[model samples]
Structure formats: structure tokens, C-alpha cells
Target: MLNEEIPDVPYHVNGVEYERGYYLADGIYPTWASFVKGFSCAVDKKRSYFTRKQAGARKDIERTFGILQGRWHILQQPARGYEVNQMRRLMYTCIIIHNIIIEDIGYNLAENDWVVEPVVRMQRTWIDRCDTRKRRTKELRDSEVHEGLR
Candidate 1:
């Protein structure tokens, strides 16, 4: 995904405009513009809040994958010999079954009770095909932008 051409699209957050998208990462990942990692030693209340929130989000994702793995033995083991499409279908099937179970067990919440977040979908106007791989790599690994975003 990093090697591909980035689209000339922009996203706004807190009134700030960003043309590049980023991933929610952990401390182990590199300090790059594309990776939004939490501070290890937060000194201020704002940093503490951000760190807590990031940890919570990561934990939620881990818990979900853990639940899926526990319920589906196929997911617990390596997906050997399965094609990409097959693996995708398997994951979807597991999720659908899991949702069904949630509804059956009265764990599912009503539509009105659910908190729906707005998704930011950026429209790509053009791709920078002229940019070389090295240039793109440098842009992605820019630590200055990473610190600013953090």
C-alpha cells in the first residue's frame, strides 16, 4: 500500500487540512507521516487523553479479532492455501454469524441507541505517477509531519 501512488486528495481534521492519510499505529512502528502513534510518556492532560484514547481504540480492535479467532477455529490458525478472495469471504461469514449470535443473545443494540460516526471519504482527482518510489518513500517517512500531527 505504501509503494502505490498516493492520490491528490485532502482531508480536514479540527479545521486542519491534510492531503495524506495515516494509519493508527503503535510505538513499535516507525515515526512516519502515515502513522499516528500515541505518546509513550505523556506529561500534559491533552497528551494523556490522546494516549488513553489511542490505547482504547487499539484494545477494542484486538478484542474484536480475539473474539473472532476464538469463535472461528479457522481464523485462529494460519490461512494456508486460501486465496485472497476466499479469506475475505471467510472473514465476512464469520462476522455475519457473529452478528447473528449477538442479535439472538439480545446483545445487539437498537438502531437509535447506536452511535454512528461520520466517515471521511476523499475523492482522488489525480495520481502523481511522475513521482519516483524513492520520493514517495521520503514523503511518507517524514518525521516532521508526524510530530505535527501528533
Candidate 2:
């Protein structure tokens, strides 16, 4: 899993070049240079701040999973389907139904009587490939970015 080579999506960050995305993982995962992990034991104010922020972000993901499981009880327990296709279909169906329900009721907001328009962003339609040297450079740049993020 650590060595998996995903397709590159080039993007600029603070004038630094990066070619791929990364995943947020816990300390148990290997330091593959692609996975960003929070400091296990923060000793200083800066480290503590980063750890707190990372924990909050992780908790948000956990809460989202909890909500999904609650809404679709099928996700609460291990999937009984033996085939990958069966599991995929089941999850896709649940997500479509969830979206329809959400669209019908709309998202509840703190301002009960007001509805805000959703923001629109540009969509990319093309993907480009990078050579070996470029990929290696990107991996190093990504590692620097990961450290800076921490």
C-alpha cells in the first residue's frame, strides 16, 4: 500500500511544486513519505497546536462515518456480501438515497429562515502524466510540505 503509485495531479503550493496527493494517517502506519501523521507526543506549544488541529480534523471524519452508519444501518456491521461488486452496489445505492433525502429536506443551518447559495468552483477535466525524475522530485517536495504542515 505504501508503494502504490497513484496518478499525478500537479498543483502549486506556496511557490513549491507537487505532483500528487497525500493521505492523513495515524502513527501506526509506515512513514512512507506520502502519509501525513500527527505527532504522537507533543512537547512544545507549536507541536501541541498541530496535534490538536490534526485530532479535530480526524474527529470530523469519524463523526461523518458515524452519521453515515446511523443513516444506513448496513454500514454499521461488516458487510455480509462476499463479492466486491455486491458491496459496491449496496454502498452506491445507500449514498444515492442519502443524497436524495438530503436534497428533499435541504441542509439544516443555524439561520433557520435563510438559505445560502452554494459556491461554484472550476472543474478540471484532464489528467497529465509525469516522468520518473519528476515523480521523485514531487515526492521530496511533498515530504517538505508535509513537514511544514505539521
Best by TM-score: 1
Q: What tens digits encode model 1's per-residue C-alpha lDDT throughout 8-120? A: 45777667787888887899999998898999999999999998998889887678778877866647657887888999898888767767877898986557463435544
| Runs off by more than 4 Å, candidate 2 | 1-7, 12-15, 79-82, 85-149
Task: For model 1, name the residue pairs that clash.
Answer: none
Model 1's lDDT to the true fold?
Answer: 0.76
Whole-model lDDT values for every prediction: 0.76, 0.63
Question: Candidate 2 has which clashing residue pairs, if any?
Answer: none
Query: Model 1 segments beyond 4 Å from truth?
Result: 3-9, 78-132
lDDT tens digits, residue span 56-137, model 2 = 8888767755777787665665776447787878767766665566668886433554343443434433332234445665
Residue 74 lDDT in candidate 2: 55
Error of 2 at 20 (Å): 1.8
Scanning candidate 1 in windows of ten residues, the lowest lDDT window is: 114-123
Candidate 2: Cα lDDT at 20: 58
Error of 2 at 69 (Å): 0.6
